[model samples]
Target: MPERVSRQLVYLVYGGKVEYHQEAKYSILSALHHAQGACPRILLYTDEPAQFIGWPVDVITLDDQILRAWTGPATYLHRRKAAAIRDALQYAEQSIFIDTDTFFLASPVKLFERLAKAPWLVDEIEGVWKEYEGDELHTVLAPYLAEQHGIDQRMLLINSGVLGFQGDASQLMDETLNLIDIMHPMVPKIHIIEQFAVSVAARHLGRPAESRGVIKHYFSGKNYWRHMVAAFFLRHGESFSAQAIEAVREVPTDKPRPVWWHRLNFRLRSVFLSSRMRSHAKLAYYATVLCADPYAKACGQGYAQELRRKAIPEGESLSIQPWSRVLTRQQKQRLAKLLGESATGHIP
Candidate 1:
């Protein structure tokens, strides 16, 4: 065994949404399954403690008032992430926070090792500020960040899926919280202000080592992973048991993507479709043909609902021409069934 390193693993889960609770539960299970010899102390800060009743971890329950205060006066919700991690410092000298929508590809001891040396570990380095100068996010905020905060070509934009640091990072957390409060008001609707703030703070603290190889964050393909996780719970049971712990090993860490030829065939079929129509068509294909399990079918239904919202304006009739042009009769029938509509003219 590698030399033992004392650390605390932290998570934040709020809300009663089943999908989110399920994600957190499965994420914890993934961590436990990958922990090789000595395991780090696991701390979960959640509003709904009942959701994790049988899990082997310390639970810090939060009330609405506490949660509201963490978001701060700006009502910038993601600021709560930094605050939650900072609170974990009281429990251990070193702390690592990972998002619920993630799974372990290797033991977290690797991350703890990096954390000991560098004192900063973010999920990934997205890119530098200058690369996205003209995009929607950077076009408006980049100049201000560059001129005011000295954000330049070297300043990175990191994904906050996994964050690791030592308890002495109170100053880092304070500065990150401050940055979040200041930047959020400028782009009130943008979702990534919290992530950028952490990057700046970590850069100030020390060089950041990335955990991409050891941890897999599935935020982009959450729907598929959600289905897979739900399936795991269904096969076993939701309650914690040695059997369930062992069974977690059977769950694949990544979503299985289509082969290249399959992707090419899909692209060729969608060549004549409008971009929006093509996107809807891919959802339909994924639902009906890609996978046969009911979980996959359920995911397909979600995709269908999303397509309906985007393709059909409220109080307007569904448009059949776009789908009709792309889908064959059988595929339309399958998609219609997923949407709970008849195959005649209801497919979106």
Candidate 2:
């Protein structure tokens, strides 16, 4: 028999939506495919384990009861993310918690090495939330966080997507739970609670956790990547053959280089967007182009045909999967405008 994995694991949680579960599948595939050093055991906590059939991962069935307890009195669902860190404590002494949208661009072993220096590793998305403290929309966890934890430095507000715990996570988890139980009731925005909790717990434990971009956090490009990934998996299924990995590697991490015509057209039409809008407009534009990328389009089309052959019920479509929608011209324009409005500084 093959040797069993007893220590050092990777944990991920995917529940509720099929699209999210599907996304998790690709994320895990990317991790396993690119991992270097001693590949740790992968543990997926979800109600659906069969989704990852042949993929070399251990599935921990997460029933509704567990979710309810994880949510507890908190009405919002984000609490479950922090609760998940608590869950990891029971299984592995050292673990890397990966979010569905994240991919291991390099060996995650380096992450464990960093974790050895500290108890936690945080994802640096927007630098520190402290930078956005003046903006109420961005600083959702501040005042309440201050009330609960006595106003610690708000320098490292991180995305909860990539978390690494080197030692016993019980203490951090307990403090995090206490922080959530109090703050969730005090402040209504539970979305940032998980990442905020991780930041707070990390602060309480040790020094600042720096981010060197070990994992490619596709936080903004997920919508496009989803379509690209779905097509890859639809063609390959659970198998991680070398060709499949190589094919996925083609799914661009950055925006496709724009042709001179596209850039020239943007310059001429730059009047409508502000400085911030220009940056977001560019991102939105690129994301739109990538959403309908030729490879993804072909894969998506093939998957749809495959589904149609199986006979989807009336009123229901074979293309019911998430991230399946092609970006309409008008819709893409509106998203660019919206992103621009949300943007604070110049993007150049």
Candidate 3:
């Protein structure tokens, strides 16, 4: 018989909010089934391991004592995400720490293969940390980065939701941890410090992370996407482990197919709201826009509406296209029913 080859990829997941828990289940289910020729192990680090009792993942129960020892008394909650990646270094040669709010559209074998050919892989390659006048981090951390590393800032910004590495990227993880240690004293909470840290280390590694849209982030559009998942669970909402998994395979993620009307609408919206406000104003404006969709926004689920702020007159990219029509009457009605709204669509 031909010798069997060892698997080349490992799917690493972590975290423990109710939303985090549900999405983690969705992420693992999607990843394992879609992996083409490899059946990689899925390692989950969570405080509530029992919640995933029967799921096909190796659960490492992360209790308080272990966390304190690992991170050394830091109260920053998100620091654990980076720490998880650092710890995952021991288990596999190739590992990806995926965010809970993501789902795989296809096998990650190609992605792992790509990582083998590069220093690191990030979900989306972006310019958020560059020398742009609007980049907030440039003003805050650039001096420290310049003084220490002889670089103004990490050039290749990335959406760190899906962080993949082929070898011991401990230097990268240490950089991330160091960034958090330095910045935690200044900021109320160190949000997204890991991305910047990884960018710094990736720069040291001397390559840009490849942009592979293999996994779709329902992150911005999750309010609507959450409704679809809830609908799928139907009566199975009670137990995530025993819930039917196949229907989650059908959540509609197709970007609004471009149409002439959509282009015109995009143009009109651009002309009307086109002035590029400073980043603060843009964030404030997006927060207000989110209010237009009340149900999911309040619970902190939807934020995709902000895409309209970046829309333009001539761009064909769906990334800048607002949902145009978020929901038809029928779709809203279904969501209403899911939320236990009445026939008249009134919430009590």
The global Cα lDDT (0 to 1) of model 2 is 0.60
Candidate 3: the clashing residue pairs are: none
Q: Please report, in order, the local distance difference test score of every candidate based on alpha carbons.
A: 0.76, 0.60, 0.57
Candidate 2 per-residue C-alpha lDDT over 85-131 given as tens digits, one digit per residue, 9 for 90 to 100: 67766776676777777766766676777777875776653466557
Question: For candidate 1, what is the lDDT?
Answer: 0.76
Model 3 segments beyond 4 Å from truth? 1-16, 69-74, 132-135, 235-245, 255-348
Q: Which number leads on lDDT?
A: 1
Clash number for every model?
A: 0, 0, 0
lDDT of 2 at 344: 15
Per-model TM values vs. the true structure:
0.85, 0.72, 0.68
Task: Sort by lDDT, best first.
Answer: 1, 2, 3
**Root-mean-square deviation of candidate 3:** 9.2
What shift in Å separates residue 163 of candidate 2 from its native position after superposition?
1.0
Candidate that beats the other on lDDT, 1 or 2, i.e. the better one: 1
Q: Residue 246 of candidate 1: its Cα lDDT?
A: 75
RMSD values, in order shown: 4.1, 9.8, 9.2
In model 3, the Cα lDDT at residue 292 comes to 25
Ranking by TM-score: 1, 2, 3
lDDT for residue 324 in candidate 1, whole number 0-100: 45
